[model samples]
Target: MKTIKNENIFFLGVDIGSTTFKAVLLTPKGKVHHTVYTRTKPMPDAILSCSGECHKCGRCNLGAISKTIDDFLASAGIDRENVACTITTGSQIVDGLVDFIKYDAYVSEISAHVAGARHYYPDVKCILDVGGQDSKAILFDEDMQMWMSKMSGICAAGTGAFLDSVAAKLNVPVEDMDEKVNYDSKLQVSSICAVLSATSVNKFKNRYPLGDIIGAACRAQARTVMSGVGELFLDYKGPIVFQGGVASNNAVGYYLKEITNNEIIIPEFHQVMGALGAACLAAELYEKKKKKDASYEEKSVFKVGVDELQQIIESVGGTPLAKKLGGLKNKLFVHKSDNGLEKIGIPSIKQVKDAIGDVHLIREFTDIFDKVVLRKPATDKGYFKKSIAMRANITRRELFSRNRDVPMVWRNLFYPPEILNAFGARTVTLETYAAFRARNPKKLQQCFDRAASKGYSAETCSFLRVLEGDEKLPTPDFAVTTTEPCQQGERIFADLVRDYNLENKYYTLHTPYKLSEHSVEQLAGGLRESVKEMEKAFGYKLEHDKLAEACEFSNQAREYAMQANEIRFTSPPLIHGSDAILNALVFSPGWGKPEFVELQKTFRDELIERKKEVELYTNIEDTHRLVWLHLPPFYSKKLMNFIEVTNNAPIVYEEVNHVGWDILDVNDPYVSLAKRILTVGFLDPELRVKKIAASAAH
Candidate 1:
């Protein structure tokens, strides 16, 4: 690579985002010299034919970026020789950029946005940036003087792309979307998904005026941001700076101001804040480097060969290597260090590997598992905590163990574990396994990609997608699923059976929607048939005595679970609901085992002991009690900790932890299991709502 020298008169920053290309030039004194912003364009077929071998294929976005830079320099009447340094940020910064433009440093999108906002308003405490592909919420801790950020998940809801889709569908120009807004519109757009929201807009276009539908879409975008990452702003005070391309949308700004009820500041260069921030960062770093060395060259910040750039582009477009290079380029430059003052250099290869690889994650979990299973429980710690560890240990040993001698059964969580216990088979609950794998995000994403390659739709339930992507899953002797709760579960199971050539061994129990004697008998008949099929496949007779024994164990476990729930209902927060929810075995295949019964007993006893001591498991004071409704993302605990520890809000109960059914009749195990499945709180809408209401009253 060639090194260039400059006279240190100007600094340049470029942001190559998913939807747009942006550039900003700044004078030595921090004044904006020039700026350029344009839509990002893809490489044309003629240019792509070169397969990136052409060093200067100016037909692609890279070429556009070069042109933008050239125009920026000419328009500002500045020469490259006078530019002290250049910094780059955004999603596509490293996509063959080294061949076109050289950057002295690179910064993350979050840090760049913060720098840009602080340049204009140093006291800005909160930032909500809704870009083309994703949204981010950044908060500045006054005491610590550090930046904290939350980003949206894989969904494109509330992003600029979502808005563009709605605009295109409504035949409204992108720039005119805000002007056509109906502020008082009472319509609603789905905030859960971008596709679904677009579908809603399509449906509404027929019934409602264009303005109302567009306004609802804008409101939905605001709501989506608030629900996903804006949870940080729940108790935040002071002015919030809204940055990014989407900030240009006045309707979104209006809805955000109305929702947050705070002063919203849109910087003079709102759409180019990231680029401005990068320029600011470049200026800061260049001065520091010159001062330290007395002689510093403007070296290329990123060095990517043709092959590496090709791989990066391919990964960005969702190839198998995507997870490996995802978010890596952003880490290639010096930026604000952990102390929030000092600048740090490039990260090591091992650090990158740890960030994206499953080895470290698996090892971390292994250490936890070893600590729980290999050592004696500490008397100082609550047994409820120990019980959770024990439950995890049981699950790890049973489901994950490779013991081909025992029949391996693939079953959904809704199916009774007691039936499999009678046959002495090891069970892998699809959802549970997915949750376990979710601990390693990169690995889980690989599974998702694999599933997508196998023709699974992106809209499929994430858990099922994970299963479909799972190439390491052991082939099961048989697979069973129920039709209740999740219809996708049975369909996915059938696909899995076909994939594994287990056609004769697959079973689906068609569970009825409503609970009645006739429904129970019908389900009971399906269960009986399934059991008979299993017996025939395994070449073993159905032992009534073993079935009855399994039911007795399940009943015992249920009693202990109920006792634990009663204690939780009456006492102060004894355990963090985050930890409590890990007792997934309560709803999984452990119910029929003696070890599960012991786990339940220990849990109940620990809660009783905690009640007597007047001690809270969470050392933090509980200012607010909350009931968690659904599953948490198993990938991270940051959200849970933020709620329970940072906000002092304790999730006292989780819906899944509730034991709502009565003891099973051991003599009539099939009928009892069928009744339990039918009456599950989650299966019945009215019952679920009533149970949630009753739990909240406690």
Candidate 2:
């Protein structure tokens, strides 16, 4: 994937790491244009730009780097064509960028840093950097030759993580931490671990002054660096350069100077030295290459305009349907709002349904999902809004894949998608479809009107009404319903089957009134019969081994959910309410599928990382953590964000997330699954009340 390029003007370098995504814009002569050092979501969902104001939330995996480049160019007032060459250096490499953005060269981090440092100070002997996660000390010989580069290993004791955690514990803003140094205090912090250091500070806060505790923490961090790579740092010659994100801390820099007894030089753009280095290296390589290849002339690197690419795709196959799909191909399901946030803008239910016919559209939808819903910085208002839109986008694609490739079952939320998944079938739950339709209010009203046109009562559930009116979505070959959880869904499903004249394709799931052995056996019997019926309809056998495998994945997804839920307990909770709810929606119905499981795991891992960061550095106080008793409106994110920003009240947990089936025992598959359904809150009203009360008390 290439973009329009020019030989003159700017050279670009991007460095994406676990904590921050840094970019440097430089001229061919190595003069800087603009530089950005952005703190990422600590997850895969990369933030293109999220200052106190504008925010663009997107996936950080495939298109992360490319989007960063595009946004950077746009923000810097440089046309993509004017960028001479884009270079990349980072720990993680995204494949989506490789196809879209043509990089002039890729260099190692050490080499880039060396070139960047040398450009500024020709005879600098050593470089010490304390970044977000790791710390590095680069040693140079008399000729400024690279000798040894020692870095903090897996432990992040002396890095930004440690300082951030301690700062939060002391109720000091990270920017103000250095000013709180009390050098007169004789406090020694032995632990370099973030949590441990925070614990140590918290203990001393009562016995000592806040400034003194911060002083001890800073010294401890500086000492930890000495312990890790002090020998080489001390052995290196004079004029050492201290750079990286943590180098901004005057106290840490001052301590290093005292300990090393050397002149410490902090360069311009110290926080983003790695990115600057990468840009300098790119500029050097581009100049060298142009001199070596006399015939090389710069050309546009763009693969093609979106419209042109769509045309190419259409011309290869040349059909009316192909052409229509080609037109829709370049358009993303979500659109940007005036405030720079993304919104789900599928004009109507019919258009989204029609898009399913083109496999390209399905692929496009999934590709934009960013794989999993990302956890973004709380300060970015667009983060959660964009996440909601992304989830809604995926819901449509999943519906398409189910209708086209597998035996589609129109079911309700209470009915598990796992049963259908076992026989290689797909489910179109009422709640899921309704959630998608919520993006467009006019379409929602049309759906309601359609339900009334079909002779359904005005009092019918809104979810069922939307499903009844949706004529563009492919008709399901099979349908399943339950009697207890929601009577309206069963009644509407029955009416739908009758109206379509496909009563034989429908099945009624009977549930016992209470949680008893007989009830479990009854549910199991229903499941077994449903599986047999599905096998007959889909022309596939019910392989217990496969069912067991799906159950294991279901269990794994449950485990991940549990982990994420635990992290939600952190102050200024790391996981957003919308992200948690969307994650539950992903797994509640489709937990058995590998993709759903993978997404849950990704979301969970992101939450864990966020928890680690927030627990350490979040300085916000008086946070009011709220537990929502029921599901909020999926279409409107304003309510959630309003509560979060205006009132400092973040919805930490939703009751529905806790209602899903717990970890399953694949060994006794039927009984385990039977018991899982038996535990649903609606089946026992007492359990729902108790669970809700428990959440509130916490």
Candidate 3:
């Protein structure tokens, strides 16, 4: 009944990455030990570096790679011979070993990297590992299985090597990045490939301070990951924990933070995530191989001669037999159940480990039933009772409001923080967060398959995977790795159009506006229309949706809602009268342009006598004759200073969308202009719509 993680046996693991060499010893309980790392030296150097001596040989430098690990273990007084298992990867180092010696099981380089990442962020849907020789982002489902894996082929642009290269150029110690990257200003870096990025950084040094440039270089590198590795990914949740050696740079983390509202989690053991996975893998194998006599051990060997290896490989190289063999790993199967069936895992420790890969890498949901803990206390209740209660909601108990009745966790995840400062972005509504998580699988596979059907390779259609990650797509009923005993229906696409425009589509050529006596009615349509325009102009939609059955955060929307609330509450109150409306009337056409509010005192007095005057009592409470425009929250602190310069006339936020606002005395002529605009909506709905469209188009 004991779990694999709870066992006490130990294991050994080594990751020989294209950029660096890493080795570690791990207990079955997942404790890491005797870890070592060195920039990938030549193979001969790598072998020699593991020796106990701190000496070097001719024609090569191991650069303290293996020795570093041996010394660590020696210092801890651990005997090397006592280690139970050893597994190797990175640069196909173990691929050659498989032909000469037998391994309990062998894992591909992609699997090892994913396993490492999963150990740190179990809910991580997409993992971007930027290493020395190559970089890749592996997309996994909610179950922590690799839905698809991709590599950067031979790009050096976003990897840690770029950082090291920059450090070399800047004369900064590689280890001292923390101090050097403490930039006061942003340093521009590359936008394209690595070579270009370096050039950009160098050119940026002429005009800006070095610290600022460094900060920019950090941003450039972070963006490279997004476009390079993360570009193809879809779903990027439960949380993204950036692991690997490159993540050690705090600035890179900061730059990445700018793009993702989700706070990046850097594990305590971030740099050693891979080594730990390897060691844990070794432990699983060692524990599974029981002690036996010579005859029993002989029985464990593969029942084939050396020629079988040649035969098996040649079959994979292309004859009819090879084509058949290549496809053996990807056969489709079917499973049927109410909600579909869950996978029944293999019993062997090695097979299970590979199947599970490094769920520990993304840091598996430490406990299995985590997602099952719904946002409420009813999660533990029986289905019948839950269903009955859910169906029993009384219409009379519901409270009516323009605001959305969504839970806060769901709220915070979708809205961007900026949106909240603008009615908190609450009157703003889009898709739900839960739907987005459920639909991720569909988003990735359908797009991937469609792209593949055309000209796009798995690598080229990576954006689908990115979307899936955002949605926390569910795992396929059956993945390629572990074959199920029975067939399961393949994952399929949903009704694309219905899912895409579920909010109900409206058609309009010119424009429309809602006009009413209510003050809320006048501003609401303008805000809504302006918001939709923003969406189309950007081609970016950041709403949470309930897809099939998954739940995720509509974090962008939640944030925007908060911003809107701030804007609504912080602005000035109503001011009106004939004299107040006539004194000032001038406006600029662009956003952030200079606006001046000048009252012609002599002209105003003569003009006031000619026009009919109605007194609007100053600071009137309810039933005031005039409507007032208040300063937005962001402008409050600034206008407070402006108020001192203006001798206490309240600064008014403007009605025009783009023009900077104006400040006016309650008795100024500009007040008349304000009253005319406010009453326009109530004058006529049809005329108002035409007027609004005409004004907005300009």
Candidate 4:
């Protein structure tokens, strides 16, 4: 082991999580000198003698965290000045150590765990950390020299806190839970929800032995971790390092081993791995600082001001018009600093290029259209693929472009776009916009963080959460939503409208769960009411002729789409399922437009040509035919590509593209639109299953 030459220097790490606070002190030789671990919200009696004054003493959390660090240093026989560097991590680290304690730096829980794991097991390939509040899995890709992580949603089912709750209910100490396990027990508890699992444990207490229930609960924890973050271990090799508070449970480790059929290694200090990792980071950063390395400075992605924006534009070889546009955009969107502009950390020219490439939205749009629409034939991209990409880009351009001539209506996917088109409006479908934004992963994550900061629950749909976090969403003239498959969609849309102070412009279609004539009539009535409200608000009369024309265009597009589907079903795999699933505009806003009809015709014609070509000489074998249910992830194509290209399993059909509804009745456009909305399978579980089964049969 390498040792630091400065014997007097020491490093400290503090991890403040939702349930616990941990501190680790390390010597100059990088060995743990002392450690402290305690609950974040410790009982007053546990910290000191209780005079029952804690209720009014709002600083109990802060006191506990400070006491832990103080005691840790005192026990180590080290003074605060002797500690060369200190770093912090965990969920509560940001706010927990504000006044009393100061830290040099902070790292994410995932990064901390990875660093800690690598300290002991340098070649570690995978890690699973199940803490009190959340769980995480980190996989190291040696080939790419990178790490990828997956975390549990805002749920406590698989976490240490959940197990502790179960232990308390069973009248058993959490430490002794592993010892009381009855491995032969057949009782299985629900791993999906913590509350439901607790309820199950309570119900089973009378029927089953205590040991059997404990065993089952432990098994449930392991299963939950496997189903949640353990998803990343699918392609993992070698032993899995298990860390965090939950790793102390031998029974859970046993089940993890059994489930994965791989070795599981629990570090001696598994509970404080995050703190250890932080300490390791502190020592490394301190060494860099000693050498006066510029890398020691903290780096973060920031919203650029005018000057930095200009530099970025010039770095990317921007045109004069582009530079002017960039400057205008920066002034409008980026925050201006009254102080001197902060220097951006440009590590290398490539990084500068990547930064500019990631955020140059207009440039990206121009490049995409130029490649897919203008240079389609030259690039060897199929006509259908080109058409899909072009249609998506066109919709994005229309929604994003500032067109003062038309009202921009924000709508849920369930609302028909044809009506908005008739009213001379551009539409922004929430899901489609989210998908478009997802093209830039870095920006999308910023949106997620922003949403979290705004108190949006992590359990909210990622699509809607993306919208909540998005500061760049175009202000809508009005908004509409449906109370059907997704109530969250309605809630979020309503919140957005409230935020924009456009209460009167907001509209919602109350869709019943079951489809019937009365329900359809009720929906039609709602649609008519919404149309009237829009007409009054925008000062434009609803013309029946324009609506009828839009519906006719939709009908023509529907015919072409049906033909395309038939060709896809009967013919060989010419189009990838990934590409087909992205034909979202068919279900999105512009179905009523002539361009959509042209897109559909081109799609159908391309499929026909591919079918003829395959029939002539190509002998493509039918491998695994998959029917994709629900929506594929919009953020990345890795999973889809792995299945289709790597595994040779073609996604034969997708439920989203299944044209199940009938052609719109142009004469009775409102009622027809209502009926079409009602027929959507997603609104009804039975209908969705039937559709899935039918698609599978093909």
RMSD (Cα, Å) for all candidates, in order, is 16.4, 21.6, 28.2, 17.5
Q: What is the TM-score of each candidate against the true structure?
A: 0.49, 0.44, 0.38, 0.49
lDDT of 2 by residue, 1-698 (tens): 11223435677887776688888988755577899887763336555553322122334344555576787789999877676566777766444445556565566566667666877887767888778888777887656454578877888788888888887777778889888788766887755577777677767889988777777777788788878777777666577888888888888877777777888888888877777888887676556534422221122111223443344354334544455555665353545668865745432323432455654343332222111111233425332344444455456655667356667777767666666677777677766777777568889888888888888667877777887887765577777777757677778778878877767777788877788889888888897787777676777797887788888888877787666666675455665576566555523566677766665566666665555555442323425688876667666675666455423466788877774555677776777777777776367888667766775665
Clashes of each: 1, 7, 102, 0
| Candidate-wise lDDT, in order | 0.76, 0.67, 0.41, 0.76
Better model by lDDT, 3 or 4? 4
Q: Candidate 3 lDDT, tens digit per residue, 462-533?
A: 433233233332222111100111111001121221233322222111112232345334343433443354
Clash pairs for candidate 1: 447-469
TM-score attained by model 4? 0.49
lDDT (C-alpha) at residue 292 in model 1? 28
Candidate order by decreasing lDDT: 4, 1, 2, 3
Error of 1 at 438 (Å): 4.5
Tell me model 3's lDDT, rounded to 2 decimals.
Answer: 0.41
Evaluate model 2: give its lDDT. 0.67
